[model samples]
Target: MKNFKIIVLAKQVPDTRNVGKDAMKEDGTVNRAVLPAIFNPEDLNALEQALRIKDKYPGSTVTLLTMGPPRAAEIIREGLYRGADNGYLLTDRAFAGSDTLATSYALSRAIMKIGDFDFILAGRQAIDGDTAQVGPQVAEKLGVPQVTYAEEIVDIKKNKAVVRRRLEKGVETVESVFPLLITVTGTAPACRPRNAKLIMKYKRATTISERQNVSEDYIFMYDDRPFLNLPEWNVGDIEAEPERLGLSGSPTKVKKVENVVFQAKEAKVLEADNQSIEWLMKELISNHTLG
Candidate 1:
């Protein structure tokens, strides 16, 4: 039909950028087990952008794709509950510890397997790694044009789309052809809150294995009640290129991570009085704390 198929790429990362005591191995690769995982914030923004696009184009559908451990399926289901038409997980032991370059390889391959798509949306950068490289890199792999740090989709037609993007000191509006990639920024509008109706209907949404972890009744109840169940994709279903599906296909690898500890001493209180303030100012100036 050549209609819109929006694919949003998301990631699950550590809650805080501060690595835990055992968060990283002697090698730079992340010891994910030691860190608490959470969804990437900007990716949520990208999801919202896709949803908005669907709202504008009546027949459009949104699909979310992620490359991470199996648990990342949770984010995919979460995307479905938020009104995405479908969710796909690109997971395999072979994809573990992939750097952005490698990770993009896996995601791009899975995306290609998904057939026709109108656009690829992603967060400008993961909170854990502020490099803002993956989205553009994925676009490169897909050989599609990309609009980075996008703030909004200003306009869209069957064959082209326009978007506003944030630059370091300014902004630029772009018009790119369909099947393009777009990476959004936090400055983009926040996603609409979860629709309670959708959540209640799709709350139990799970992948085949995810449902296996629980009682059959649970999944049955949701599936029977379309309002209760949502769609989720598993690894084998997407027909990804096996050699390109995991870590082996990736070129970049994490070497190690060293936590830099900056200790703070006891706090000192300073009076608000003018003379005391002057003394503190002079001391700060002398110590180069202030110019």
Candidate 2:
């Protein structure tokens, strides 16, 4: 099989499952400082898919591309530890408050800059915002075919790939040509653990912005080892239109946020008998909580 150039789109998302009181700001944006940042789960699945391709076809490269804050470069190192060849971090104030549409536009432009990739893979949705729209939107912007909810890449030929998809009701297997975009679902195989050797190899990898804050001694090492320098691109680096970035390009607006705290007014104790279960079901049906 011919080697493929694969780009995996990853994201560093706040662990929303552990959200605390400070998780959201007054402006309705996320307060990432208070929340723990994690690699998006499904994106790991996407990365695993890319790595599989690299494993099967020697000389194939898996490049990770993510758009977020400077701190988000952590995920790039995470990818490097998991077998990605290299990574690019897209960061700038212009990308702040970007909704899915703006994010897709920015990523599409970055993909164009990277050029000549055989495949683009991303998570089905980000946990922070479960819209699941960015991957397809990027494909639309790039004018390429897209396969969503991909469970596995069953096979790959010189110019095409066969993918198994996890659907709402069942699974589906389909084939698509190269230069395709795929959004991997959580149903896919979980990512392999970090390789100790790879971790040791790339532990010092830092983006340019991150390098600025480090010690002068490490700066020399970073300069000597080019791979240790992860690329950090800003809006200007991508040549994106200022008007079509960040909040200005986002059509969605958060008008309001309400916190509803439910309090238990009463409680009833019941047995596990069928009669009790039937009565509970009927009560739920009467209240429209079940039918």
Candidate lDDT scores, in order, read 0.79, 0.93
Per-residue alpha-carbon lDDT of model 1 for 154-203, expressed as tens digits?
Answer: 98866789899999999998899978999999999998777787777566
Give the runs in model 1 whose Cα sits over 4 Å from its true position. 1-3, 17-36, 218-247, 262-291
| Model 2 alpha-carbon drift over 4 Å, by segment | 20-31, 262-264, 269-291
lDDT of 2 at 46: 99
lDDT of 2 by residue, 1-291 (tens): 589999999999989888777776776666778988999999999999999999999999999999999999999999999999999999999999888999999999999998889899999999989999999999999999999999999999767899999999999999999799999999899999999999999999999888888898778897688999999998888899978889999999887766544886777989999999999999999999986
Q: Could you estimate the TM-score for every candidate?
A: 0.81, 0.89
TM-score of 2: 0.89
Candidate 2: residue 159 Cα off by (Å):
1.6
Which residue pairs in candidate 1 collide? 27-255, 27-256, 28-255, 28-256, 28-257, 94-247, 201-227, 201-228
